[model samples]
Target: MGRSGPAACGQTVAYGLAVGVALAATVQAAKADPLQDPYGTWTLQAENDAVSTLKGTSDQYYTSGLRFGWTSGTNNQPPAISNLNSFIWGPGTQRIAIGLQQLIFTPRQTQVSQPAPGDRPYAGVLLATVNLISDTDVTRSVAGIQAGVLGSYAGGYQVQNGFHSLISDTPNRGWSHQLPNQPILEIDAGRTWRLPLITRYGISADVLPEVSGEAGDFRTYAQIGGTVRIGQGLDSDFGTPRITPGLDGTDAYKATRPFVWYAFAGADGQAVAYDATLQGSTFRSGEPHVSKIWDVGEFEGGAAVLWHGFRLSYTQTWQTNEFQNSKALFNFGSVALSAKF
Candidate 1:
């Protein structure tokens, strides 16, 4: 029906999956390690709204994101951080991660330099985060803290327009009305449990359910959701690592088979308390703002492949509107490369 509709979703995911499968040809299978050991993996991820190959969708609202993260080997974490995490989340095998990310958002109409009334506000955010996670075969607990800045310091304008010029795409002209600079601090934690459904042949299936909360200037919300995944090596890791405000897993994983693969679908709903991008500057007087919707939902589908110790993943996401009178379905794609040592 629409560019962000199911037809587009299929084409987008089909295009998204090509690279991961291609990498499978380059890797040779080996013996998998233990099922529960995930240590020393690094992940690099990038997300954008330009994944069409079918019907191109407009690049607006959560248009771009980049993240890099590393998880520590089990028991090789910072003592103070790991101890505090174990104390709060309860004892289990523990690892800590460090991450850096930048995200950019814009209004539906980018044709004018001035702000579009009744549209999502323009905003940019950059954050550095620390995460500690504990795991057993069937359950996982995680806690995280992030600090960063919003607005120009995050370089939304320069990065977006620079890339646009490079690709000869239409320039986004609304950065003049972007949110004012503000410091941001956020903290979040959650727990997820795995329910084994069945294992047939070398393929298996499982459901991962979770509950989580976040609070601070960046965003405040409580969420509940679950993921259903099927493929080979279901016991290799928790789920998939993602930048949140939604469901996500971690990069930490070990080789449970010489070659591993899986496809997944997940959905989540959020009861939002506040969202800085939609509500505008926290402490400043003059900034763009919009009427925000308190409830939002997202649907996602994707796949991952790991050969030897290297992993590759692709995910496509569709989100409900976040602001008043918005037409966007928030279609986006995430591609990630990760490796375990």
Candidate 2:
């Protein structure tokens, strides 16, 4: 949990090197259209269970993500509606996207001290996702689906602890670790409606309803929820707001205004049938044996702003406890920056 000045400097240098490599890759691939579309976007996002500061205990995790997206300019084929296409690849305004994500989880000192034989290990997950998003109206209405795989790597605990030491300014106290290594399949869909009356006052409102599910060693459950947003609406697609990065294609570039901003809030509930992290299995093992909590809920609020072609957003979320005997409620924050070309 503690970090030395030299270690912090090393982490910074490493991050800078990563950014340099990404920039170089972008330049090298500039001539090739990865998405085969004229319109494209790139987004970078970071999420952490620790908001303003890092803590050693409950719900300690960090995630970093990058996404690339593209939209088709013209509909060359007739719109088709099928379970696979509707969810995997929307029928209307065709769009496709890909994302890469890294997640790390750490245990609290309390848990480490009173380990349950073989529990409380540091874990890390790496994921890659492919998504499809579309808008029939090309503005207000939108839908999307995403699929991805999650994998675990060695030395995740050590690597993450080093980063945490830098953030919390505490030296790393090594601990035992076990993480799930599995492939996950996910699918979801949503629709958004713009409120007509609010538009007259330079403010806009919309409601979105969505449902999603995941299958793998990580989780096996289904989720459904709705969200309402009110803000300065620019012509764009209604993108689902979540801690994880995904596709959010829009026609905002075509808007008359050069800047756009908005504030949003939402609630979602989940029926957790199974969670590998809590209830260990043959594939993955962990401590503090847990019972399946069928009901879980979350509340979130956030704001976003877009100027020229760059967009920035921030959100704060409070989550209900996930397992029994869990005393603290989980809270986290997410920040994202994106640009359209």
Candidate 3:
């Protein structure tokens, strides 16, 4: 599929916005104010994975049409590898946080030789997988991070040690499709400690296995970062507590709502780095250990608006890594709508 196809670049933007909007509306209501039962859930979907070739260091790399799902776990523990989800908190909203893991079916192509002089038919099969998500609340004085983990396995029906397969073959069009399942897992977590400084900023980080499977012989990295409030919370451009609608346009109510604040609104940009090493992974297939390590960094900025329980927001993610010698880049744009009950 083309990079701009419905399942590629364009799709990521569409979903990112959808999720952002939903979060904005929820946050607007609880801006700076802690609620009694501030809790909710949001689904997590993988939009796109775009990578550019870094001439000297890394080989051409990329993965597209990722998994889609909700989360299954607690506000504290990492999201489960299973397809399920519990509570979901918002990044902008301090109310509550939530996580998700979604299972999606992907179609793979197949080719066959025809006995006659005619074009052979192309067949495809479904690849089912589980995704992870983590959403938490960030109040004016406190912030909490979430995590999600996914590991690929086979023969899950058996209990003992049968759940560690990295490859599987299924019958399709009278042919066996041997698929190497990449066991990818993610660890996302964040915490905000109150500081004496007038400006409030807290560090956050996450870890991921660089190489699939072979846990012991794998690459791991962690992100260390913080976010700061640009000015006095009350004096930010978002608004002065009251909704000031525009003179023209229907974009009413101009107040820095909870989750829905424009890019560079009251909060400054956040910086995170990927710091990990190769440690090898455990796999059912038992291939020799693979060596993998990732060194990447990202700068993210966002703007959002919220009214009642409705939200709309936009966030841009700029990514750069050291693995490939040069630079590999990608961005995130999302739109979402949801309620907080």
Candidate 4:
């Protein structure tokens, strides 16, 4: 895999747009408005489809992901970001983040040496992202840009097999036919609105509805969803952090009390336009890929605990099959930890 490819032109444009969005709006970001001091926060998140671990086997289909991110304080953002965000959103607090992410996808038959007929091909993605979030108590808007690699260059073989070996699990034998190496570029943005339902006697509840999308050579889709949460500090933030193309969340949460907790559930539907993972190589001419199902649905439930500046959260996701002739339903788990500065 190399840096330049047939999508080179699209890559350049995506990079330029991402840079512009970052410089103008700041990055993915940190802190509730109350914690708007000069300092920021750091967060680490992981997603795995290890549900089959109990059976001493590996699960497949959008299997694993890891991301480390940081967000700036709600206040004290750079002048350029503040100005642009204010212009675009009409007066709101801003936070920015720059982070790296990795994702791995595989078919159910990882033990097979050859590609599975009519099944998704092996794929891996590694990317760097810049995110900017603007918030008003009522609504939050986000914009992000990402650039990186898809395929062998993403090190799926090393990371996946290494981890599998560590756990005495079978290594996926189909890496040789993984999606060819290619550059990936995506521009991501979304908006979320808060609707407060209850706030009294140290308990709070609210609804957050959103519409979002991503566009690039790697993937492009639009989604609509909402989450309802009931907890101690409903003002902390919208929801939990997600890998992408799904629900949205921030690494930072308001510290309303010494301890806080919440339970939440959400659902969404997607209309996918392009997915290189299913379509195979974006730049290469010949590759193996499965027939794609244009519409997909997903729902998730989770809980979180917030103690002062540190937050721990976990989510379980269920999604419909994304490929034609495949009736597999994917179940994955994601965990995230964050610390405020």
Q: Which lDDT value does model 1 have at 145?
A: 95
User: Candidate 4, which segments miss by more than 4 Å at Cα?
Assistant: 1-37, 51-57
Candidate scoring better on lDDT of 2 and 3: 2
User: Which candidate achieves the best TM-score against the true structure?
Assistant: 1
Global lDDT scores for all candidate models: 0.83, 0.52, 0.28, 0.83
lDDT (10s digit) by residue, model 3, range 110-131: 2232211211111111233222
State the displacement of the C-alpha of residue 67, model 2, in Å, after optimal TM-score superposition: 7.1
lDDT (Cα, tens digit) per residue for candidate 4, span 249-283: 76756766788899999998899998998998878
Q: How many backbone clashes does candidate 3 have?
A: 67
lDDT per residue as tens, model 1, 25-101: 32211111224453588889988887532344566788888899988888677678777987987667788889999
- Looking at model 4, report the run of 10 residues with the lowest lDDT sum: 26-35
Off by over 4 Å in 2: 1-37, 52-90, 110-121, 138-155, 165-168, 171-175, 180-197, 244-256, 281-289
Q: For every model shown, what is its TM-score relative to the native structure?
A: 0.87, 0.68, 0.38, 0.86
Q: Output the TM-score of candidate 3.
A: 0.38
Clashing pairs in model 1, backbone N/Cα/C closer than 3 A:
none
Instruction: Count clashing residue pairs per candidate.
Output: 0, 7, 67, 9
Misplaced by over 4 Å in model 3 are: 1-33, 38-46, 49-99, 102-179, 182-188, 193-219, 228-260, 265-281, 284-294, 325-327, 332-337
3 or 4, which is superior by TM-score? Answer: 4
